[model samples]
Target: MQVSRTATKEDFNHLRIDDIKQPISESRFDALLEKLQINNLSEDEKDFFQSIVEDRMVTEEEFSTLTYEQTKKIKQFTSRSDLEGNYIADSSIGFEKLSMAPLLSAQNISDDEEYNEAIFNTFKKLNLSQDDGISMLNELGGYINQEEKIIFEDSLTDEQYDSGIRYKTYIGLDMKELVSKRLEELNQGLLETSDEDVKSDYKNMIYVYREIETQYNNIQDKNRVENEAQLEQYTRNTKPNPLYNADVVELYNNITHEYEEKEKKEFDELMDKLDISNLNNREKELFRTILEDKEISNIEMDKLSYEEMKKINQFIFKKDEKGEIIDDTLIRTNSRINALLRTTELTDDETFNQVLFNTVKSMNDIYEINNFLNPILNLISEKFTAFDEVNSINFITEDMNKVLDELIKTFDEHYQETEYDEIKEHYLSVINKYQDLKEQYNKTTIDS
Candidate 1:
């Protein structure tokens, strides 16, 4: 008879069971048990080892006890290099098996405490420390609670089927009542807490609860007819067609005709009240030309010729008490030029010239030229000439003409440089023509 021998650490490194070509003899089995140091083996362990030698099949229960070193030895014995070849020796699989075994077995442990104890012990066996084991158990409890919530939601009755509303009619718990209770609790908390942060947190919680409660109640009391109408709008099969309905088509045509007739009547009344008969021939023609359009835009007003604009300006701004045309455009332009003149530095001749040029070009009519531009030109001429204020400044003096001629020359020079080149050219022509006209008028008066 072969007696069993105790396994040495070096013996395990040389172990190779897969190389065995035949079933282990009784002596070899005894020797294998001795190498594994299983003298006090239980019946289950004995049967497990016996099956490995007799039938060459490893059981999960037998394999579960294997460490990484034991797995490596098994791989060597099985002519496999990968330790993972032993499925039951994998830590992940072992964790799953260990974790699930207690759960499956606890199907009979109806007591919650007992079941928890079983889970705790299973997790403990998984080599987790006490704190880690408790934390994992807490996480599992949270997951289970979430699953229970889902199940509860799915099991809601028709009366409690409002989505996102946490009210449970089946449990006779009204979310509004819960909100009221929470509000009372929050008020109490606010009174009890001296800490501002804690009070703020309680207030915020109350706000959230109140919002949820209000929304839930509002949804519960929603008008069924309106809801049904909205739902019908979303899901209705038939669409309205105004053209297909004779009454609707007739109503639309009648309304459109009525609107057109009303607009025409109003326009004709406005045209009838417009009396351009007193206007001069040129003004009448220009007014008629503008009347050709059913409407006049500000852009069209800006595009009017200088002569045409003059007639409109004279009619619009009739003579005031001082026998001067009260043209707001010229007044505003003069005010703006005066403001610029007041702000301008005397030595900044470039800026002064540019302002003068722009102001002259902005005049849209003869009225603006006389009232707005002439005054600005006079100011510029005065600025250029060395005149003693006590002496009256003659309008057609050599000094004024010299200043005017220099300004005209400057305008011509800036014509190509300015964006308003056409307007600048027009200004130069106006100044030259004005000087010529003034000289002729003065000579005529002298001759008479």
Candidate 2:
């Protein structure tokens, strides 16, 4: 069997899946599972599976054992039938945010201890020596308390089903904002921040972010209804045809999901290959923003368009670790905060602002199903720009001009009678600016 992306080094040494073909059915999967020798399952593992069968609550260790099995089963994403079959009788047993965590926890963090010992394991994860982790927490740890740590960890989880949308709706974003602020403050505190305890907290924040993204899937599967509804409302307004509005909205929702899936797939594949430990805070923030993009709820997506890419940029930059929007009003003093960073990312305050602007800018165009611009104006040219038939980007730029012409014509023809300045002016501004930016980009290409 090919090693599953989620497989462990331990599994790598003991197991080989060179022969487990895709589309393996239950019988086939059963035999494969048996061959792995469940009899060898640790005492904890045996109790876990039996509990799962009994529909009793097994401990976290049990959850981890089964996760290993589910992952092996889930690698069959290409085969829907095979994937579907895994969940036929016992629905909750499948891989999704629902299944992966227990397995990850068991594999990564052992469960010999229940509460305090378990929370203490966070020390190892934060990359602090176990001693340092225990010591720092041991020092001021009285402040958080054992029970408080448990609650904090539990609350931070972006788990499915149990994770209320309100978690992302407000909680997650707020946490992100808070963490970002903490990081920013730490950046300022350069000297003051170096207390070993502070460093430990910084590492802990990263762990929290990772687990949230890993399990929550960016709140994607969670927000289908609300997004579709808003799209329906938008559709109703645009067509002025109440009769077909339901159909129109449903169709539009499907398109929105599909477009989102495409970008998400690309982004996911990209991240699975990265060595995350090497990346810095800025890089991680960018990547997290990208991953978390697809996981958002429909309502958020609906509200996101007005901001353009700038919205994404601001959302991330202004965000704390938990993912909340920062106050733009903070800018007057935040400029000083930005200055303290020694990285290549936030070149200046303007560039910092641009990152936020760009994040939301490309969002809608690439993800909207009926996005007229990309479908019509979109161009694909050979990557060999030096010897290509026509420079690809240049070709795309030219195609964009044609698309722009169509935009102007559409506005002129449709709004000719309406004296709605706001509606007319808004679209006209969009067209003019889009064209100017594209042309300027191409001009730079030409000059180069």
Task: Write model 1 residue lDDT over 1-448, tens digit each, in one string.
Answer: 1111112223334545445445655556555555433355555644544555354545545555653223323322221112212211111111223333322222112112222233333442454443333333332231122222233333444343332212111122222444477578777876875444345546655554454444434433353345675664423222232122443334334543554465456434433443333456555555544432222323334345433543343333234445564332122122322322322222234333333433444544545545435543456546644432312122332333345466556656666466785777766676565465346434544565
What is the C-alpha local distance difference test score of each model?
Answer: 0.39, 0.33
TM-score of each: 0.18, 0.28
Tens digits of per-residue lDDT for model 2, 1-448? 2111122223334432443323344444344335332234455643434444333133445433433334322322211112112322212123223322322232222111111222333332454443333333322121121222222223332342122111111111223344346556534543444234334444554454344333323332333345786664433211232322343334434543554465456444443432123444555455344324222222222233222322233322333334443332122112211222111122222332233233323333323312323322232222211222211122222343454466566656655656898877755655555565456545644665
What lDDT does candidate 2 reach at residue 62?
44
Candidate with best TM-score: 2
Off by over 4 Å in 2: 1-49, 54-99, 102-106, 109-403, 417-426, 442-447
Cα shift from native, residue 129, model 1 (Å): 72
